[model samples]
Target chain A: MIQWAADVSMLVIGVSLLLSLWRVLIGPSVPDRMAALDAATANVIAGIVVFAIRDDTLDYIDSALVIALLSFVGTVAVAKFLAKGVIIERDSD
Target chain B: MSEILTSLLILTGAFFLLVGTLGLLRFPDVYNRLHSVGKASTLGVVSTLLASVVYFWAQQSTLSVKQLAIVVFLYMSSPVGTHMMARAAHLIGIPLAKETQRDDLKKRRGSVPANE
Candidate 1:
């Protein structure tokens, strides 16, 4: 039963990933792409967690944590760049 | 019994993830996409993480702090990231869909132009 659930969930995640990929590829604008990327990152984390459960191993959880932090930072930086046109700000304006 | 619960949670999470990505693909505007991805995907990921935490606790007889930490971090950050992205899209003057009826932000902020 556990294996059946995992297999089905994996298929669903795969479909989700593909849909996000399509959005990333056919972006009409930059922010759209960024949003898609953010969604993709979240999906990947979900995938990792599911894989960890299926494998019955706790090690992949660490990778999931790291990816979560990195993706948040990446999203914030990209949003900042989009808003201000520069990720790095200077004191002398 | 616990195994069944874990599987149910994971399957539900996967469903939400699929719904989120579907919204991302079909939404007509960036803001709408943000709304979809932000809410659905966050819930999806959180549910799945909770499942893993439960799974490890039940099967291995030990709690997984890392999975719990990931869930906490994601819940805290995902909404903030979505808000920032929405603000950025607005600052850059991304237009709303034709079906949009009201411009609440413009009404609230008046004629002040975006920071270009």
Candidate 2:
């Protein structure tokens, strides 16, 4: 029963991932693409958690953690660049 | 019993994720898209993580600290990231959709300079 549930949930998440990918591909503006990318990363993390649960393993949670951290950093960097035209500002002025 | 609960959580999480992605695809503008993706996906991811936490605890009779950490991190970061993205869009002058109703930020900020 749990296995069947896992399978169904995975299918649903797979569809969600694909839809986010479609947005990424066709998004007209930079921030639109960024939002799609962010959603995709979240979807992937959820997928990893589900996979770990289905496999009855705890190790994959670490990978999810790493991905979450990296994606947050990447999103912030890109956002800073978009806002300020530079990722690392040298001076307040 | 626990399996049913876990499954329900997982299914609901998946539904929220689907809705978020659909919004990302269908929303007209970046800000609106951000609004949809940010809230829905965060809830979805958190729900899924909770399901996993429950499953692990049921199987092993102990909680997984790492899963909880991931949930905490996600809850903290996703909103910040979305806000940053929205601010960036505003700073970069991404125009609102044609159907937008108001420009409260513009009114509050005393109008953007003609050059910007």
Candidate of highest DockQ: 1
Q: Write the per-residue lDDT of candidate 1 for residues A5-91, one digit (tens) a residue.
A: 988999999899989999999979888998899889888999998998899888888888888899999999999999988998888
Model 1 misplaced regions, further than 4 Å: B111-113
Q: iRMS value of model 1?
A: 0.7
Give the alpha carbon lDDT tens digit for every residue of B20-115 in model 2: 999898888999999998899989999999999889889998888888898889889988999999988887789999999998866765666622
Scanning candidate 2 chain A in windows of ten residues, the lowest lDDT window is A84-93
TM (chain A), candidate 2? 0.94
Interface RMSD for each of the candidates: 0.7, 1.4
lDDT of 2 by residue, A1-93 (tens): 778878888999999999999999999889999999999998999899889888998888889999999999999999998887889876667
Off by over 4 Å in 2: B111-116
Q: How much is the lDDT of residue A62 in candidate 1?
A: 82
Docking class of 1: high
Question: TM-score of each candidate?
Answer: 0.95, 0.94
